[model samples]
Target: MQDKYATLAPALDSPANEGFAITPSDSSDLQQVTRALYVGEGGDLAVEMRDGASLTFKDVPQGSILPLRVRKVLQQTTAAYLVGLC
Candidate 1:
């Protein structure tokens, strides 16, 4: 039998806790985000996937980590702090 799903490649290096101000674009320069932990510092972060799906995080306190799979970030939104754990 064969696996139904393929495993993603391991990250070349450890994930760094970096701040990013995501903006929507038609550019395909987006990275292949396998997983990410949202670091609550600023306000809540809203995520939009490539499949036209959306997810919003509300009332997340500071230092909270929310794991999610993201294909792209929404445009013209508030700052969403996250630690990319790919």
Candidate 2:
């Protein structure tokens, strides 16, 4: 089946953490959940678990991507990428 990403996926964590600096090294484990980012030319972005349930930039705006510190652990977590509602 073709996995689909939602327009505004559920937020599992925030972006600004006190004692954390998370960064997705691969972004593979999150091949199931859809991320919350505005499609733009700022490079492809994927939602990630910074600490628990929040976002890096809350919303990816309309033409920007989340910073690396506020994303998933690449080969870890269970998030996904999205452009619109499938």
Task: Using TM-score, give the best candidate's number.
Answer: 1
What TM-score quantifies how close candidate 2 is to the native fold?
0.22
Q: What would the per-residue lDDT of candidate 1 be over residues 1-86, giving only the tens digit for each residue?
A: 76443354445353433444334443442466535655546555566654657766665576765556666655533445544445
Write one digit per residue (lDDT tens) for candidate 2, span 1-86: 54354344544353321232233555343333333332343333434554545433333434543334233433332333323211
Provide the global lDDT of candidate 1 against the true structure: 0.53
Query: Each prediction's Cα lDDT score?
Result: 0.53, 0.36
TM-scores of all predicted structures: 0.51, 0.22
The C-alpha RMSD in Å for every predicted model, in order, reads 8.3, 14.6
Query: Which regions of candidate 2 deviate over 4 angstroms?
Result: 1-29, 32-48, 56-59, 69-86
